[model samples]
Target: MMAQPLLCEVLIDPERAKGLSLQQWDLLIRQARHADLLARLAYLLEGQSGVPTAAQRHLDSAWTFAQRQAQSVRYEVASIQKALSDLGIPVVLLKGAAYIMAGLPAAPGRLLSDIDILVPKPCLERVENGLLLYGWRTTHHDEYDQTYYRQWMHEIPPMKHGVRGTVIDVHHAILPPTARLKPDSSKMLVAAVALAAEPGVCVFSPVDMVLHSATHLFHEGELEHGLRDLVDLDALLRHFGDQSGFWEQLVERAVALDLVRPLYYALRYTAQMVATPIPPFVVKALDKLGRPSALISSLMDCLFARALRPSHVSCDSQWTALARWMLYIRSHYLRMPFHLLFPHLIRKAVKKRQGSGSLTEPIVVKE
Candidate 1:
């Protein structure tokens, strides 16, 4: 049996690419694409010699496309900040935009489909209107989706640029108002680090960035980009893990934010899959603080072991589909109690039955 996907092996040790056959490179590229890590692979393998000419061409192309996309993100974010600058509220960039603006290690080779930002909850309406006046319009025109986002979910309906086709998600919080864990958005906002390069723009502190990435991936209904997100966590950790007191700050911050579980899963999976260098003391700290029940822990190990693999034929067993499905259901369950989740499931089921189903949530999962 294949113990790990070739892409994962290459990720942990880019030198593995030095000896691969062209046929193996073909398979690796396909798997990396499926996992949304093709460009990331290119970035990691850069400067490494012995890549076949054909493979090098594809990697170069992927990296170039990613670079172009990253540049576009910068322009779009500037427009977004300018749109809301008059409102006088600090605009907190989230996810990809944040990574790019903050110059985090996760920014390079990342593909961003939309721009996300967080503002104070009280400024939600004003921020929405501010973007509206700048020619950004809300998407998810369906009434149910509008309500689902405005009422329960983390952010407002996704807003897109009429001329540029850029999408922006403005948020008051990371997780939904209805979610099980209630991390204090106010606390996070206070700790947000202002970007020196982009005045009036800020990102979560290093600890919060890692915690939010973990929470988003583990709580998401879709696992299509699971491996990609895990890679982001790996980058964030490796980068931040260097600062003095970073490991202790991570533990304390997770406790303060009530995000220990997601942090635990992030650290464990990144270590398992990417060979992310996590210290033993940090693992021991979380093991006591956030470890699940024995039965649940074993089940999670089984499920994520399968679900976190590259979603490709060569990388998975027949059980992979089942694992993804179960994790999807589990994500919904984790976010909301049965009472709330059941109705949403039924509504979505009816839509699927009618053959016009669309997820109420945005394509990119919110916290």
Candidate 2:
């Protein structure tokens, strides 16, 4: 544990680049790309002491894409704001979109797949209808798919803009009702902070923001972007760590939100992977609510240590694929109760078999 991965070492001290040979830089670049962190590393190393010209070109290209993505997110947010304005629904931005709008340190070079927003459950119909009017159409056409989403999920099926091809995930809650932990959506909605710079756009309060990000990553099935997400957690922690009572508030909110488990996972991995600074007392406070048993903790360490590394070939051992598959199954197990889960998994397997080589290919499973 004394030595970190090269990518983590470089992130912790960008000045370390002065010592890395071209071959090392090549491996690092590949690692970052597979982790979905090439751009974030680029942002971190921009003016650091020694970056080779060849590597700079690749980093620069990623930076350009990140810049365009930020601007595009802004335009799309504005369009969404306008679309919901008349209905008086508050659009609570989440994750990447929230980071960008709020000018969080995490925003820079943050690559985003889609915009996510939260509205009250009562407003779901109105919000969907309004978005439809703005050329956003429900993309899931299957009857079972629609029922699966509506009957037992956190958010509805994703909506894609007919014209722009951008996707949005609209949520009324964080965790699905079927999920083991259910945080009160109403409290988050009430506590949301409005972005004065961008009217009509609200984001989770600082503590809520941190908790949600933790919950999103640790509770999810997929881990291909695991390291990128761990980086996001590191960034948010570093940015917010200095605020008065920030750590205390984080611990308190995690308890209040039934999110201590995710918070523990977040704190542990961010610190382990990227050296994210978290107060010892804050970690200690969650011993009862968050910490797993010693045996379980050791097992998770084995899984996450492999799963959270870059998915690049260089990072894998004989067990890497199995580690990720185990975590994927673990996430789905935590997502819903057994009565619904067993049947759902069987149905999905059957559908996958039935849809092979057809236009109605089975959905790529995700949280």
Candidate 3:
């Protein structure tokens, strides 16, 4: 009988028979080799034996840039944190960037594109204004977009410094379009502990951070390098492995927040990817969500396609069809009240054309 193929083999990209001379490309392949990320690394590097070259190149550059940008961002973020501190706006860094910035050894060399920070809603304008004073400018500024952000979304616009060229995403809430789930950003914030050295900036409580990363993966339909996200899940679980009550609290919080679905998907994927030991009770709770195994398998095939990079969407029609349907479902869930959902959606469609769309505009931010 044939043995099962290694997970690494099933996950990695096939090797390139040619064009290995590019230093950046060679370095990536070599690092992936050392890091055991080779399959996905090679998959990303080789351009069309059937895949698109430009997309391959773009993703490659992003990967390389992410490594180079890491050291610089730590200092830059520290400076920004100081500036926010002066203004009394508390800032919390999110995800991989947060992990790296906290001086965690294994994290520094990994790829990260942006720094995510969360500030209180009341201080949203102050944070933006503070960053602007420091020579960071908002990239996607339109009155309509501003109105949408100010009135509806969970955060203000993303800011990019002209000189540094690194983008900082400032968020006030973890999940937007509030009706879809109730994982409270406030609870997350309250649980946030200060990074030991980077005292000014905070990180999500381990469970919240892991949950957020998982939600981002599953919610986006796991469309990018599936391996990269799997790596993130692995890292988070490994980091938080010894924490007592981590799993139990995660489920209780998800149940209270109505975000059990993504939590289930996250646990299932993590269990599959890294063999994390989820309790049988947790497994049974997930099973009650009704054949998630089959549902996610179907969703993976129909609702998603892994493009190495964002611009790889060569066909507008195909991209739009998938995006539109996803947005429709997302918006429908965002509207908890079915009776008002359609009219709200129509209003949103009009506002979107007028460039005033946002997921949480109608819900007021309470102190």
Candidate 4:
């Protein structure tokens, strides 16, 4: 069967298009044309002047007013970083902020709507309280919603600053309770390096950062409309290369955290889309995690169906299914004792059936 025609225009910039192979060009254009992705696309296209007319038109069509909104977000991010420093909480700005601070040339033009900062788990309350004092407050919700954010979620309630109106996502962990897998944030903190020339500010080690990005996409099940995120995984892999023990370390880390399945999805999608270099040893390590069975595949399909493989783009139901299974299998492996699993499952089902009600309701004895 013939493949669907790619929407991005042909590359006209000789220099910009120079080192890229045909497949790389295809990935770039496809990523650039992603819906809700004009900011990131504009950032990637900044240095190249001779973009194809067709691609330029496609980009123009995708651009939105959010570009201006991102500017305010950027300024507020800088201020928040300074504030975090003042409170003696070492902050590592993740994703959107890190990309900007790196001076990647692929920065600036991209739209950034939020500020993500990481603090040690022990310092989580202190950091949240500090941000509050600096005028960042939680969303208005009932006690249940607050409890959900403070207890179950990896991050605190999304805090909005009074003056800036900018949202800050303060993370103490990378995954949510629903993810069923957890990485050691403490270990990540220890391996982190201070942001270049930015004292008291730090970011994850390159491998951890990349893995975290992949996990964010995989666990969030947000790939169906994820052409830009695919580009992110590609860029990180290409930038990091295979010279480092990245793949092996990633496998080991995933196993330690019981996150092997997400790692599998990450490697598979990255390889399929960007042809990322995966060393032989890394492939060998994946063997231990085993491949997903048919049952696992169907489960992943349900999870990522709405998140990653939206029909408007590509119908990657097969890929989504496979990813979902891997995720579920990993979740099963990550579970504690059999006894704990059943009770947890029952509680979750009951909570889910409560239908948007907060989990704060207390159970009472029958009269």
Clashing residue pairs in candidate 1 (N, C-alpha, C atoms within 3 angstroms): none
Error of 4 at 120 (Å): 1.6
lDDT of 4 by residue, 11-120 (tens): 12225554555565556556444433555565556557666565566555444433455455456656776667776666877876776666443244445547787888
- Looking at model 2, residue 305 earns an lDDT score of 91
* Model 2 residue 100 distance off true place after TM-score fit, in angstroms: 0.7
Rank by lDDT, highest first: 1, 2, 4, 3
Q: Pick the candidate with the highest TM-score.
A: 1
**lDDT tens per residue, model 2, 1-367:** 3235688788877888787899999999998877778999999998876788889999998898888889999899999998998987678999999999899999999988889999999999999999999999999999999999999988999999998888899999998898888789888899999999777789999889989988988888789889888988898998889899999988988888889999999999998888898888987887767899999999998999988888888888889899998998888888898888999989988988897867432422112
What TM-score, over all chains together, does every model reach?
0.95, 0.94, 0.67, 0.70
C-alpha local distance difference test of each model: 0.88, 0.88, 0.60, 0.61
Worst 10 residues of 1 by lDDT: 358-367
Give the local distance difference test score of model 1.
0.88
1 versus 2: better TM-score goes to: 1
Per-residue lDDT over 247-350 for candidate 1, one digit per residue giving the tens place of the 0 to 100 score: 99999999999999999999999999999999999999999999999999999989898999998889888888899999999998887889988999999889
Indicate whether candidate 2 or candidate 4 has the larger TM-score.
2
TM-score of 1: 0.95
C-alpha lDDT (0 to 100) for residue 317 of candidate 4 = 42
Evaluation by TM-score, superior candidate among 1 and 4: 1
